[model samples]
Target: METVEDVTRMRLVGGNLALDFINTRTGPAAGPPDDDLLTGYPALIAWGVHAGALTRAEAARLRRLSRDDPGRADTTFARALSTRDDLDEVFRSLAAGGSPTAPALARLRDHEADALAHARLQPGNPFAWTWREDHTLARPLRPVVHAAVQLLTTAALDRIKGCEGCSFIFNDESKNRSRRWCSMDDCGTTEKIRRYVAARRTRARQ
Candidate 1:
């Protein structure tokens, strides 16, 4: 059960924006998610803001635009969900030492193309790509796709991993690539307590 506070204070365990977006749905390892943070288009915008993909002012404007055109908002929200699934498929396959499906790769390529089309190169000591201030319902997706492109093309692509305890995906930036859980405070602690209890129960029975 996701609430406003949940979205606002959601954990940013995934080191990359695209990976973090994939981590939106939280559940046990084998079944349905207990909480999906992006309940609607507004929730999507809130997440984008929380993830630093969109500025607060930009999120506010996008929310107002979504209210004005609910049909488009719904369509955009549906697209976002689809993208999230496709991304998960791609990353999950890679993490499991496999290739992404052709259709998923094609869909991601299309989104990256669209994102790049709307972005402009900002002049700086190190030039960077930035999204245009477009008043579109799909504005929040720009940075997400950008991050996806970055991860897909970089050495860090090999570091993509799924949590041992749950469905969450994250970049394993540990020096030895030995990090297992999404966070030590969440899944790690839970698994530790579960193992300890099970061992104690076994000893008592014996």
Candidate 2:
């Protein structure tokens, strides 16, 4: 099946799948109006595929499901995005050495239960996991919960970082853990050029 839509404008700079979902609402794409990357249900499906949350066939199936009951699909899509923002806040708080609010943790627990409802052990490894269906609307968000759980329980929390250029969150996987800016070639370079131009202008004014 053909793609539901083009998601080439969506940036996949986040080091993790959950981070990719959070980064969606942060960066504006190039072009007129420069809208949010996940603008609607179709856009969300495309993002899921681009971000490795879903395969092309899975995305196509989700596209059909969403179109079948557009209202519920829209509501679910909105809820997923809202959860993404909440996750962003929760992660930011945790990364800053503050505890997540009860409600935040509660919400994550809810997502965790829902995610597990459709999960199954993979064939070869009892430890390996897999989702039951790709067409489910919220299936794309299951990884977000899993990723969040991993960071909350492991050393990765220490690597959580905010991009100085645009405030997008990413995991710092560099050897020195010095990664910043969701994408060095994009936001990083853009900000560097802006600062350079401003400094040159200031020097000329002196």
Candidate 3:
């Protein structure tokens, strides 16, 4: 009964991990966009692959498990979408030049704790933190939860930004820190065309 899109449309323009996770929805956060790329368990897993939270093999395995275990898979998908929305709230406050309140911060911490409760210290590069879960369909999202916690606790929030063209969040990591737009090829181009058209229209009217 569930409709699914195998290809992931989630954008990865956000320069930071958490911001990239939130960019999955392509339009206004509240309004229904053309489509939510994260439509089902497969979509969530696909996003996981795109976000580097899971390898191709891992994502493919999770997708297969979703079909076999629809009941728990559905619940996992729901929780992933819910966390995505809650992250929107947490980052929205930061993007608006305000710190997340105590309640908001608590919610983030709760999610972080819940995520790690399912993870363990994964060994790899000494500088990296990793975990491997054999059966948690929702395991991929734990990295995102941790990424959110990292951004909130560090000075990374200071570089956070929203695209004026489409409200897609990103980090301005330019040398001068003046970068904007989710991407120079997409939203940036659109805004340029918009401004050019506006200037031409004004000249014609005058």
Point out the worst 10-residue segment of candidate 1 by lDDT.
Answer: 1-10
Q: What is the C-alpha lDDT profile of model 2 across 1-206, one tens digit per residue?
A: 22335464667776777777777655433222223566678888778778877788887888888889899889988888888867877877765667789998888888878887877867774475677453477877887777777667775677887676664777888999877678878888998899999999999999
Per-model TM-score versus the true fold: 0.92, 0.83, 0.86
**Distance from true location, Cα of 83 in model 3, Å:** 0.7
lDDT of 1 by residue, 1-206 (tens): 57755777878998899989988887876567687888889889989989999898998898889989999999999999998988888888887778899999999999989888888899998998887566678889888987987898884666888888998888999999988899999999999999999999999999
lDDT of 3 by residue, 1-46 (tens): 2234433545677866778878776675334444456777877787
- Candidate with best lDDT: 1
**Candidate 3 wrong stretches, greater than 4 Å:** 1-9, 28-34, 123-125
lDDT of 3 at 113: 88
lDDT of each: 0.87, 0.74, 0.77
Write down the worst ten-residue block by lDDT for model 3: 1-10
**What would the TM-score be for candidate 1 when compared with the true structure?**
0.92
* Predicted structure with the largest TM-score when compared to the true one: 1
